[model samples]
Target chain A: MSKPAIAIDMGGTRIKIGIVKDNVILVSASIDADSGNGLRNRLPDIEKIVKDLMNGQKLTPEDIAGLGIASPGIIDTNEKKILSIDKKFGDAPEIDMEEWCQQAFGLSFCIENDARAALLGEWKYGKAKNYDNAVLMTLGTGVGSAAVMEGHLLRGKHFTAGILGGHFIINYKGETCNCGNKGCVETEASTWKLPSIAKEYSSFSDTKIAHVSPIDYELIFKLAGEGDFAAMEIRDQSLQAWAACAINLIHAYDPEILVLTGGIMASSSYIIPYIRQQVENHAWTPWGKVKIEEAEFPASAALYGMAYLVNSVG
Target chain B: MSKPAIAIDMGGTRIKIGIVKDNVILVSASIDADSGNGLRNRLPDIEKIVKDLMNGQKLTPEDIAGLGIASPGIIDTNEKKILSIDKKFGDAPEIDMEEWCQQAFGLSFCIENDARAALLGEWKYGKAKNYDNAVLMTLGTGVGSAAVMEGHLLRGKHFTAGILGGHFIINYKGETCNCGNKGCVETEASTWKLPSIAKEYSSFSDTKIAHVSPIDYELIFKLAGEGDFAAMEIRDQSLQAWAACAINLIHAYDPEILVLTGGIMASSSYIIPYIRQQVENHAWTPWGKVKIEEAEFPASAALYGMAYLVNSVG
Candidate 1:
């Protein structure tokens, strides 16, 4: 059994705060993120939410072991500091998270990249358990990943190892990515890029998919199921791009199991079979087949990861 | 001072054997490979060459610590046996290398992938020295690679981790790779794929490049330098593909240094600058720039790596 810890999963649009123990989130709350304004403005709200959640559980800071944060972007996990932030949490690099934790709760705390944190959670307590070599592919707004080789997380000098799967160039002649690379998996198939990808298809203007407000994977899958040509084309292309990304991860990390998570995994029924077949036919693993599985705690894996990190690291 | 060690680098066309000490090849020999007949038939020849090479050095098997082999395939280094082989070395998986080494020389031995051996050689004593996080991209018949993360080789469960950089899907919509994946860096720009890629160009037949027998990068670069339009186009695409692969490596491994080697590196004068600029402009390394450098021991890095492994490990 592990002591309770407060976990913060800071995302682009929402900040999920929870009180976690062992492998479960006991109580949780979510707050809207004004990410464009920066993380500095949200510090007070996060602190208050954490306090209220603990109070509702009849707990105090003294009852908790520590706090852990799962934030987007590169992080110096050893230093417990945000190294660089992307579109979300713009001011995270400037804020001293450790100092804030010390002032707010007088507790020890740690931080890790959200993707890595989610992987840690899954690897430690979810689908990837018992496997020394594993990879986590979290598909949502963008593809996120982490690799564990021989039971060790691959954190390179800059702590960016194995976390940039979305940015890998999967199409040299394709569109430019926000990362300034050409034809990234994210650029070709991510939710944020789907509308544009669909619009570029010649038949898109003649289809119902083009008229949908904020086109997403669910709508695409639905329309594709109904035999809409443009939707099916976009959906099939996206699936291939994602399958390619999966194979890339399989080759790059050489993992025995690849754990898939994130919001997009809600449609795992349609995605898993396609990806598994592609990997079976394509990956060059001679040892045996790579097991592909869904994450057990998709929505809260990062929180459990924070709990595991906060409790285990010190 | 280190004791002498025997090292063997097995390739498709040639087998290089060497007696090494103190990071240098004291004596060496090479033999043509009848790979189609399998590695078993070549074993007696390898034993004879190694013994003769030692005799020339006035040394015996008793004077060496151990022997190490750098073979092209997935290897079980712990077991000192090949796990799986590619186009070359067909019967490797069936051969008992450890038993052969014991019977031939009565010495202990280890085996590793050829690309990883080169990286270990570079990381331990060559250009990648002092960098705990490094990557080696050896561009030859195919783009071979190996990665060192935090001073540990990234050999995953299948012993295939980090050595498949060429197989990474850099173009999801591109040509199919021999490995069955589509748009691999190798499929897009490797030496084996260069002729087909060049012939696909609309103006290939009109250019002098189309007249060359067994077309390779050297001729492509030379013709491009002479302002041949088709050559220039092929050269540029290959450069971009290689560059994309470089960025993919930097992102995947998060290395501080990337050491480029292999036969293709003879044109590093032209290849280096192009890859460096692409990595600088596109890699999402917020920590700083990843230093791209040439391999220190281009032709014999694997031999030195075997020496290091044999000498360092108990």
Candidate 2:
């Protein structure tokens, strides 16, 4: 007899909105996002989307118990504020999420970093069920990650401990990231860096992917499967970075299960086995092997977790 | 009044024994450690030494509530046993420390890794007195470290999270460590690795200390202070490695204070300032500056922590 909650996963290209109850999504929909204009300028658009979602569902502000929003950035959920900005967020921190939720839906609201909320979702209902210690890494444009250790999200002395796993320096002098670090794993393998990394392959001069405007991991895997030498080389290199990042995560977080989410995992067939081999060979876990798996419910996951979060808080 | 605890810090070179009551060391003493042979062969010697210390004070086993030991290696404190042998402990896990205490003093025992015990001691009574989150690192023969994040010790999913900060790879292809990792901070800055690292320094052929028996951070710092070109180069490089590791630790464990302890910090006069500078300059903490300090008691810190372990567990 607890009240239902509205879960929102706000992303760059699209925002996923869902009404969840008892860990199930009752109604869900995706709306186009006006992200290129920057998160700072998209306030009215985002407000409209949330209001429309609630109106379309025929739910009044009093009907829902609370609202949960997952956004891309450094979020100190305690403050309910977006802390940092990156490629995905052009206008953030300025967007008063709490006020918007109060004015539009007349509900109490909670917000957390997208990766962290996804981890919460997985821990409550998805691949991480029954796991007290785990990490979920979303390998998309940038390597997004969060960790749960000893039955709690690993928010550290300043709530930044577990979320910065992607900024881990895998190569000391490899590549530059806008985070002011050099040779971070994300700077070498993530979708944001994939095009430049692909260009370094010997076959980049002749591959079919060269024709694509925004080349990515998907195209690399597909082209490699078609026997493109350069594509295979870069693909293997990217796999190494991801696998190394996984090993680093295993070392740092000591989580039992590392769940891979995000768009790049759509090519799970190629990435999974390759990364698994590297982990077995390189990771320094003396106790036993860490379980590596893929996420199942993904974009709707934070919504599902929202259902349980409100109850737990109460 | 709280019951008094007997704390012992066991090292390859020395043993420090202290009687602690409510976080204050009432009395303490030290004796040469048995390191010419394996540590397993020296337990009886260790026990006899502790007995002598107590006898000098005219105290009996019945007066002590429990014994706490800080040894150098992996520890299974819950079971009151050492788990493995590192450089100092050739055969430690084979020894039954808890049984030894029971037979000799008719008392229970608690044991922990030296690095972890030091952090615990600091958290409870030393520099990190009021801080609930902290990471303490000892830059001795190899970098030894432990972390407390958000008021909890990060034992991780594998019981290796905070204790293995030295093994964190700063450069995946940088250098090799005995733990099977490459470019770890320890492999670059620790005393045990300094000889080989110094050899590659340009001044190695001409430095005054190169003619000495063992080339270590001690000689490097000494010579660097005296204007040896090669020694200064090696010293600065190693400092940079350690500084990077500190920033990495800040991001990984998210501790409010980072404590530098152990042998290399014998010249903390130089290492402390540089680390604080680098952290302030490079570390991505928007909250504020991460405080850096030297271990207050240094050599006797783990012994102080041993008392804490005994009291908390026994």
Candidate 3:
């Protein structure tokens, strides 16, 4: 009664392909993106992986409804194309996804920004299913966000409405962001920028954080738990930045629920309560307090979202 | 034939009331709000002003569709009630406006936040009429904003969505806002806080600005024109704050046009160009440039908006 769909969640380091039906992934496969080769060069590998997954699941093109892709960068959902390519997939915009879908599987296709697709996935089958108005913020190398206002995905004039939450300036005089803005939340506390932010502290050389190679939130949280002063300070500052970002997003989109996702959420025991407390104290929601919660799916959210999207469109 | 509607724009200092029909104000009247006397105490005066204006215009309740009041607080448009009271009108939330309207005259009534009403007025008859997605920022004592996205007013779950644009934190480590946030646009650039902001500067005592009894944007702009360094510095900072505010709004609401209004626009020559340049350089709008324009009607926009609202809901 339900048709299977080919779902792909394309990220910076890995490509996840799956055959999904009835909100379940029948068979999934993944490969190193080797993004240095560019998305254009990886087409053949992606085709092979999808075919192998379908064959392993005993599925054919006729058994599938369509294909859905969740990708980084600005996605033109109507065109089923990636409009703007970020560092991970420099050649993504040049790829004809619809043509590829047609040739590889004789299937129609749909696409959405990875963050938006994740939010959609959450809304359809995850934590945000109960909320009509919700926002999803994924904290990792960069902050990625999506807003669903009154149950509709906020795709603005340029299709960048809900996805650019990371770029909202939390501190106008703070630091320069890659997006050509100063003091963006991502620039202030994201994984890629955290090292520099931590290094700029007053006594960085004396702190244990200064000696740690490949700096990340996990190491910082661990050091902070061990009563390292500098680590504690940076952790608090990062939390404050994230809290400010959540408040900013809350003010911007006016969502009833905020879904916190991505790698940083692995520290949910410390992160969730801190952000919730900060937002509860600061955000001006007269009607009621916004519910802050961890995302239901951590890794395969966008994959499920892609399947959901394909099914919805089909 | 169009029916007349009694429209009111209630503010801290003045109450603007008008008899409007077909988007035009037929006869208008005003009275001091005497806000110290409380909104409940001034209800009779408001009723008298409305009655006198209607009588002078040779109109009666039978000839009018309904009454529309735009007030400076969280307004429950559904119940025609003011839900939240600010400092200026402490008694607003307690007053049953629907009951008062029924007692004053046998007429239906509706209400909306003043800024939202102004935006609607602009959307219906002023500069923003050409664009479906637009944002309006009124900068003076405080920064007020309203957004129309895809031709619909953004009233969030709490009725605070578009109205809280001023409270969006531009600097997380900047200043403590009354709304419990740090470095809100209002906290940085509003008229009420400008003097304190100026006083915090290094050379404030030596500058010509220190001699000015009441430091305001008008005096600051004039002194900046006359080449006063302190005034120029403060003015530049203010413009930066405002520019950051505009970009924040642009990122948040995704508008096609940003309408600058309020008393501070008196320095439009310097203010507009500075903000436009900053936003053009910093904002990440990939579709095209958001048209920055001045509001067509500053004083009577809310009155017209109230009339439009009354007519639509009558």
Task: Write the residue-wise lDDT of candidate 2 on A222-255 in tens digits.
Answer: 8889998888888887887888778777777888
Q: Which regions of candidate 3 fall more than 4 Å away from where they truly are? A: none
Best by TM-score: 1
Instruction: Give the alpha carbon lDDT tens digit for every residue of A277-306 in model 3.
Output: 989998878678999999998887898888
Candidate 1 is scored at a TM of 0.97
Model 2 Cα lDDT, one tens digit per residue, B191-262: 878778877766567778679878878888888899988888888878877877787778778788998899
Q: Residue-wise lDDT of candidate 3 within B1-314, one digit each (tens)?
A: 55889999888778888898756889988888888778988889889988998899888899999999988777778767777655777888888988899899889999999999999989989999978899999998788889998878988777877887788888887778877777788898989888898899899999999998789999999999999999998898889888888988888888899999988999998888888898888888866799999889988889888888888898
Task: State in Å the error of residue A1, model 2.
Answer: 3.9
State which candidate, 1 or 3, has the greater DockQ.
1
lDDT scores of the candidates, listed in order: 0.89, 0.78, 0.86
Worst 10 residues of 1 chain B by lDDT: B78-87
Can you rank all candidates by lDDT, best first? 1, 3, 2
Q: Please write out the lDDT profile of model 1 over residues B15-132, one tens digit for every residue.
A: 9999988578888999998888899999999999988887888887789989999998788888778987777878889888888998999988989999999999998889999998
Alpha carbon deviation, residue B82, candidate 1 (Å):
1.9
Q: Comparing 1 and 2 by DockQ, which wins?
A: 1
What lDDT tens digits, residue by residue, belong to model 1 across residues A40-92? 99999999999899899999888998999999888999888888776777778
Model 2 chain A: ten consecutive residues of lowest lDDT: A305-314
Superior candidate under DockQ, 2 versus 3: 3
Clashing pairs in 1: A170-B170
